[model samples]
Target: MSFVAPWFLVALLLVPAAAAVYVWWERRRTRGAEPWATAPLMPSVTRGGSRRHRHVAPAIYLLAAAVLIVALARPQHDVTKKIEQATVMLVTDRSGSMRSADLKPNRMEAVKAAASSFLDQVPAQIRVGALAFNQKTKLLASPTTDRARVKNALNTLTGAGSTATGDALAAALAIVRPQGAAGVQTPAAVVLLSDGANVRGRDPIALARRAGRLKVPVYTIALGTDEGTLTSKRANGTTKTERVPPDREAMRQIADASGGTTSDAPTTEALQAVYKRLGSAVAEQPGKDQLTSLPVGIALVLLVVGAGVSLRLTGRIV
Candidate 1:
């Protein structure tokens, strides 16, 4: 917490000073009464019950005074608030390797389900975009709050061609944080999910560095397991199988270069969980909120309660 007018806090010293004065007056009055009332008659002369109870209302009033003094200082505090105009780009690999059946139905179908779950978890105000990449990159949807369009793009995606991770990241960065454009765009992020290595695209590490320069983080998810494999027909009237393990080291490099996080989603459930966590992580930013009204409200409540207690105990409110 910080205060706009910190000098106003000096007034807080008066509360304790007032308490000291009240204590001195009570002691002096008790000494004067002792000259007239004997020890046996002192109990009758003074109010019944514990004498400490008589200080309750005054203590509450002093507390109220301190709170009001703090309120006058106009305190402010940092708060985590949702960035309504924030945008997130979902860059997914639609390369042939995604057809590997290691995770449930297949890696592609699992990614779609997890992406849908991500969309559902994100705030309504946050716009989401989609991109599908293979040997070539294609923009399925630009960042928009309309979930249906993004989901439609996801549903229409089919795995083919070679993995082009770098090209996809470049495309997403262009949409969210274009080069040499204007003052400042709203907070933007890219979520990249891919299986297998980057084989036929621009250098992914270089692209991730560019993303970092633009202050746009790229959260990378390496999907699929080591045991994953894909079987396809060769050009020569024969069938061949190849290992399609996710390149976790490359994914980590991309994330580290872009100042983002790297996640390994070996299973469909893990992928969905990672997406859900990112949904909450990207939607908010730290902001400052004034807390003046809070202290003021507390002071008012304290004053009212103190006055009621004072009247009930002493037949007068001070």
Candidate 2:
């Protein structure tokens, strides 16, 4: 618990002071009272009522004052809440290298399965977008809460052409940037799944720096093994084998530049684990909640109880 106006707590000293004054006055009035003659002859004179019950109302009143004083301080508590309005841009590399038979049936198929599972795990309220990049980058789906649309876009992705990692990042950033109401940017994240290094378009590192300036972290997942190979079809209909190993160094650099983390997923299971972790990371948001109303409500209840008890016991409300 914390207080916004902590200085208001100084008023709490008045409660104890009021109690002390009541005690002193009661003692003084008792000392100055006339003594009844033959008081020892009557048992009721010495045992009129329970002393504990006599002080209950006063104690309650004092507690009520203390509670009210605390409420004036504007107490607050830390709370972790789900970010319902946050946007997550899924940037996938559909370059020809993603067809390498390094993970399961193929890198692209494994990624699509893992990505779909990730979508299912994330909160339904969180807006998700998808972008596919190869020799060129294009927005497959704009950010929206329609899970069906995002999933459909992922299913339509086909691996072909060269890698354009920089263009993909730029496109994802554009989709995740601040929009609508007051131009205030919502909390956002980018999940980039790639298997090979950039071979065309702009430099990925430069675009990563831009994303960093915009405060958008790009989590990079390098998927594939060092022995990964791809079979390419030539113009003459001949097939040629080519090495398409995972570009861990390039992915790590991009993640670092954009204030994000990089993970190496050499297997389909590892890729799913990465997506699950990202789902949790992107869901929770930390904030402070004022607790003044709680203390205020407690004080009101105490005041009512004190008044009722005083009237029932003393024939007058305090």
What C-alpha lDDT values do all the predictions have?
A: 0.90, 0.86
TM-score of predicted structure 2: 0.65
List TM-score per model, in order: 0.67, 0.65
Q: How much does candidate 1 score in TM-score?
A: 0.67
Poorest lDDT segment (10 consecutive residues) of candidate 1: 42-51
Worst 10 residues of 2 by lDDT: 40-49
List where candidate 2 sits over 4 angstroms from the true fold. Answer: 1-54, 73-86, 95-97, 121-126, 134-136, 145-149, 155-167, 179-187, 195-220, 225-264, 276-293
lDDT tens per residue, model 2, 195-222: 9889888899998988887777899999
Clashes of each: 0, 0
Residue-wise C-alpha lDDT for candidate 1, range 1-318, written one tens digit per residue = 899899999999999899999999878877888888998887567654356877888899999999999999999998998887888999999999999999989999999999999999999999999999999999999888999889989999888889888888888888987753467767888999999789976999999998888878899999999999999998998999999999999999999999899999999999999999998988976678999999999999999999898788866786
Q: What is the lDDT of residue 13 in candidate 2?
A: 86
How many clashing pairs does model 2 include?
A: 0
Give the top-scoring candidate (TM-score): 1
